[model samples]
Target chain A: MKISEIARLVDANIYCKGNEDTDIRCAFACDMMSDVLAYVKNQAILVTGLVNPQVIRTAEMMDIPCVIIVRGKEPTPLMLEIAADRGITVMNTKLRMYSVCGILYNHGLPADEGE
Target chain B: MGALHLEYTVAPDDFSRAGEVSGIVKRTLKDLGFPPAVVRRTAIAMYEAEINMVIHANGGKITADITPEEIMIVFADQGPGIPDIDLAMQEGWSTASEDIRDMGFGAGMGLPNIQKSTDYMDVQTTVGVGTTITIKIFVTQ
Candidate 1:
């Protein structure tokens, strides 16, 4: 799914648009940066509720191009700055983490089964 | 390609700038034309160690030596060292405070994640002195 499509589906607002047309096939939802670092494989979208600069840092480390902030949480300015600098798209959604994952899953976005 | 060396100092408890060194290293690897997998692995491994340095060790120094065959990274700190390496290496074992946990880290997966991401890992520590971690990720053509 393209990042723009996911934004539409989840009613999210793109805070920093790095690449709206980037296509992603998988998603990993986790607030713990360590789990994301340990498990995420392949280029996928990151769905997280944690609002901090580390979220952006984790995405940059994993080469994750997009991060969806759930539960209407706002990202810090440093987070947006890093996201913009790293060419990572940052989005905010009022939907909870579970709902965002379910919506994406229903739309054929498979979970990133880090293997 | 000729060997390249880089170094950076991490400020203690600087959560805001934790991944700066890893970010630079990741970009360097990418610029050197490393495979995406290799670059990602190196970045993840180094980033985990960098975070540990800030969270546990009050900050440290990270040095990266990059060669065509592999990238070697060293993280050295003078903070409270691990008393039990085996227990520290275990997943879901952490001594981070509640504040750290609220920051979305301290899940006790840092060391394990580093092990999973790199090709080789070596840890040296003293109970009250300090700790140093060295990791190498081979470049596969």
Candidate 2:
């Protein structure tokens, strides 16, 4: 799915105009940066309620093109700066994490491909 | 032969800057055209250690030696060291404060995740003294 489509699907606000055109095949939703780092696959979108620099750092390390902040949380200035600097698309939704995951998963975004 | 050497001092609770060193090292590896897998694993391992330094140790210094064969990252800290290595290495063991948990870490996944990303990992710790972790990731075709 595309970033714009996911944003519309989850009712999120796009905080970065990065390469949203990048088609993502899977998505990983978790609040733990460790889990995100340990399990995420290439070109995946990270959907989490964790709003911090580590979120963007994890995205950068994993080469994840997009990060969706759920629970109506706001990304810190540092988070936004790094996301923009790294060319990562950052978005946020009022929907909670489980809901966020369900919506995206129902939209044909692969949740997990079994490692 | 010895290759690139990098060092950085992490400040206590400096959430905004925890991954600076890792980011730089990752970019350097990518610029050098290391395999994508190698670069990503190196970056994740180093970043986890960096976050651990801030969250658990209050702060520390990291030294990295990068060569064609391997990347060795040493994390040295003077915080209250781990009393039990076995417990700390477990996937779900953590001693981090609630504040650390709010940041989306402290779920006891740092050490295990580090081990998962690197080819080899060694931890030397002394209660009340400190801990030094060395992780070496080798480059392979």
- Model 2, residue B41: what's the lDDT? 87
DockQ of the two-chain complex in candidate 1: 0.87
Per-candidate count of clashing residue pairs (backbone under 3 Å): 1, 0
Could you report the Cα RMSD, in angstroms, for every candidate shown?
1.0, 1.7
TM-score of each: 0.97, 0.94
Cα-based lDDT for every prediction: 0.92, 0.88
Q: What TM-score would you give candidate 2 relative to the actual structure?
A: 0.94
Candidate 2 i-RMS (Å)? 1.0
- Tens digit of per-residue lDDT, candidate 1, span A9-105: 9999999988777889899999888888888887889999999999999999988999999999998999999999999999999999999999999
Candidate 1 TM-score, C-alpha based:
0.97
lDDT for B62 (candidate 1): 93
- Which candidate number maximizes lDDT? 1
lDDT at A108, model 2: 90
lDDT of 2 by residue, B1-99 (tens): 449998988888788789888999999999877889899889999998999888888889999898988889999999889999899889989998898
